[model samples]
Target chain A: MDKFTVLSAVAAPLPEENIDTDKIIPARFLKTTKRTGLGVHAFDSMRYRADGSENPDFVLNQEPYRKAEILITYDNLGCGSSREHAPWALLDFGIRCVIAPSFADIFHNNCFKNGILPIVLPHDVCTQLMEDARMGGNARLTIDLPRQVVVRPDGTEVPFNVDPLRKKLLLEGLDDIGQTLQHEKEITTFEERRAQAQPWIPRIVLD
Target chain B: MAPRTLFDKIWDSHVVETLPDKTAILYIDRHLVHEVTSPQAFEGLRMSGRRLRHPDATIAVVDHNVPTSDRTQPIEEAESRNQIETLERNVKEFGVPYFPLLSARQGIVHVVGPEQGISLPGMTIVCGDSHTSTHGAMGALAFGIGTSEVEHVMATQTILQKPAKNMKVVVEGQVGPGVTAKDIMLAIIGHIGTAGGTGHVIEFAGSAIRELDMAGRMTICNMSIEAGARAGLVAPDETTFEYVRGRPFAPKGEAFDEAVAYWKTLAADEGAHYDRVVELRAEDITPVLTWGTSPETVIPVTGTVPDPASEADPGKRAQMQRMLDYMGLEAGQKIAGTPVDVVFIGSCTNSRIEDLRAAAAIAAGRKVAEGVRAMIVPGSGIVKAQAEEEGLDKVFLEAGFEWREAGCSMCLGMNPDRLTPGQRCASTSNRNFEGRQGPGGRTHLLSPAMAAAAAVTGCLTDVRELI
Candidate 1:
């Protein structure tokens, strides 16, 4: 996981609501065993035409926005599926932060695990950010993690809230698995106690 | 002491250690794995030189990309075949118990879990699919995790987590005929928008919820994710106990009695506090379906398509307009009479034997309307065998609905079954998202009975009228 501190980059605006994981990276592209190289397939359905050419109408297909590191969208962004590939695709495609009024629960957590920042802002604030995004290259947004604010191109700062622990993890780029492993003894003790209290909760012995 | 919710009790019992910020290292009792999500997790474990901490507690199956047609033949899609083969090799190397495509028990991971009693009361279950919430019907703390979390569980048998606030969705009174659990869930999602249950765990209660069978309860909990909640719970009771009693992997004799005793105590205590409460009358919930791409874009079967012009918010109006265009529906058109090209009656949401029976009852002695291709893909080999024994397959086959083998099939369209561009479908699957059934496939989510009604009428027909 890459450490996320402060990033200043162009943000792409997708003004739709409930842009689900299926649309982010279709199930067809989910067959890969490895996580890398999904950037080209990000938003596969909308990004490309049926003949495999770029769909000029898509925001990501446009100039300057093609290299966007932040995304601004409407409510309930990433609303369906628990597929981690959604975030993987976004990260691979250079999107590091997503600003929305709200997000689906699984996708929100998936974003953090993959080092993509999913920032929930007020609806009006997100609308403003989307407008700023529409200005293209000249309107680069700066996300300051330590200060917990999104700095606009006009030099205005809008603060946001994130879980303190998750915020720390992102700033440090710490491995969660490594952090949890430090309590290996406690996990072992819990397993032993659970075994005695509920012996039937072990393996599923199929006939 | 304050009263604890069922979710609280299960969560507290599973805590291995609590951090200062309320995040806990939670011990997972079961980890369900599928082809699409587990391969990368396994790859991560291999790359890190980590051994699976508890392979016995994990179970793997192939569903999403498996061909639902003949299992004897080779998988034609090269990428899909490689993915399945990758899982087969990974599970073998990792020593996890697996139900391969040819196994009699192989099916959708959610269905396979409960059917084999792998998901039990008072356990914490995690899978890489959002529908893992379906196991919450067993009085478990089950939710979906990302591939990173999957790898975490594989290496440590635990996950990092924070407790969600409690929410109670109380649906009172009994549903009338033609109204099923699927209808109740759709109605609930409609009442609460797609993001309504975010950051909370919903405990579905009240008289109507109690009246539902185990299968019905699973259907309700299964779509909690669709409502933006990580998990949904229905406290375990006699109904849940009865369903688990004879399952192959369930405990035997004295151990079963012991388990039931503990399970009986897993319900929310009296005077339990909830962060929020949403109430509904089951009798008021008629046969309902999704008219647009989102699950929240639902209305009763008798309602007309909504006009975006009536929406107060401009952003929402534009979104509605886009959905209306994609759905090819007029602003004020009646939803009931809309024609459909396909009818699908299977998925983790509605692929159990009970769902099959409900659809077969409607299909009995009724011919599928011309130009409508309907298919019934049973949830698993066990479900298929059970349906056949009850002659539900005969009823569906005679009614012109193709009786297919188990797997996800048209649900996610990763397999051979799919819809072409601009094909409208009446489906029993959980999601109605854009291209969820296939690229350019338009899906209308409904109950199995409703789907069958659509198949026979060649349009979206109310099951009440058909009955």
Candidate 2:
């Protein structure tokens, strides 16, 4: 994962609510072992038509929005399923930030783990951002994580808040495994005590 | 000292270490894996040269991608075949116990874990699927995790997690006739918007919840994710112990007694503190039908579509309009008698044998309405076989339903079973998100019995009326 502090990019507008993981990347495209080549499949059903041609009405297929790096969406974005592929596809599609009124918990966490910023703003601000995003390629919004502000394409800015630890981890690009290992000694001691207390509990021994 | 809520009791007991930042390293008692999400996690394990830390504590089941139809034949979809095959290869290589595709033991991961007694009280369970919360019904701290976290648990047998705030939903009074757990769950979600329970683990209690059986509790907990809760739990009691006593993976004899003794102490103390609380009267709950894309956009079966103009919040008003447009429904139109193209009754949420029994009871001596595609999918192969032995399949087939094998059939449309574009269905599944069952498919969440009612009427009809 890459450290995320400040990003400035064109914003695309997807005003639909409850844009679930299955819509972000359908289960049919989830068979790949690697995360590469998933950008084309991001929003697979909506982005492409039954005849395999691009859906002209899809915002991602429209001019200027095709290269959008910031996505502004509605409430309950990424609402269903716990597929990590949702964030993987978004990041692969070059979307660095998602602005919404609210996000499903798992999807929000997955976004941070994959270096994508999911910004939760007030509903009115999200509405304003969606309108700003309709300005096409010229709608460049800048997110400053350290300062907790989203600078709109215009000079106006919207303030936001994030958990301090999450913000630090995002700024430092620290993976959860490495951070968790910092307390390995305590974990090992606890496991030993638990194993002694519950002999019937199962454990696996590595050779 | 405060009397901790049930969620706090289970969560605190599993913590190996806690940091000043409030994150804790919690030991995982069981990790369930499925074909859809485990392939990538297993691949990551291989790439990192790490072996599973606790293979005995992990169980894999191929459910999501398996074809519910013609199990003896090879899976026709190339992607589905590859996903299932990769799981088999990975499970074999890791030396982990797994139920292969079409195996009698293979079922939806959430369904298999509990039915086999692998999910126990006072344990922390996790899977890469959101319905992992279904295990929390057994007095456990269970929630969904991402694939990266799945690998973390596989390699370390622990996950770094922040404890969720505690919430209790108290449903008092007895449920009226024809009301089921599915109806109560929908009512709860509608009461609290989709994001209301965010960052909280909800414990279902009170008289009505206590009256529910294990299967009913599972149905409620399975949809906890829809309410944005980290997990849902009910204190383990005699009903729980009886359900687990004879299952294959459960402890035997003396061990079982000891486990039950421990589980008996898993309930909240008399003055337990909750961060938040919501109360509902069971008599107030009714058969629910979702009129929009989100689970929260629901009303009682006897109600009508909500008019957006009546909404106080501007954003909510806009959302209602969008939902109405997608659903092709007019505000103020009654929900009942609204035409339905299909009736699907199966999912991790409501596909257990009891769920099947409810549907079968309603379908007995009735025929599905002409032009309606009605199907009943059992939760597991065992459930299917048991239903057949009890003639539940006959009841369904006689009613003109397609009696299908187990798996997540027509739930999220990963397989061949799905609705076509613009099709509207009355479903027993949890989600009603846009295109969840298929491209341009509209879903109205309902109970199994209500789905049978819809199948017979060719419209959304109140099961109580039929009864």
- Give the candidate number with the greatest lDDT: 1
RMSD of 1: 1.2
In candidate 1, the residue pairs with backbone N, CA or C atoms under 3 Å apart (3 or more residues apart, or in different chains) clash, namely none
lDDT by residue for model 2 over B378-397, one digit each (tens)? 88988888999999998999
TM-score of chain A of 1: 0.97
Q: Where is model 1 more than 4 Å wrong at Cα?
A: A205-207
The backbone clash count of each candidate, in order, is 0, 0
List pairs with backbone clashes in candidate 2: none
B11-43 per-residue lDDT for model 1 (tens digits): 999999999998999999899999999889999
Q: Which residue runs does candidate 2 get wrong by more than 4 Å?
A: A45-52, A131-139, A154-159, A202-207, B312-314
**Worst lDDT 10-window in candidate 1 chain B:** B243-252
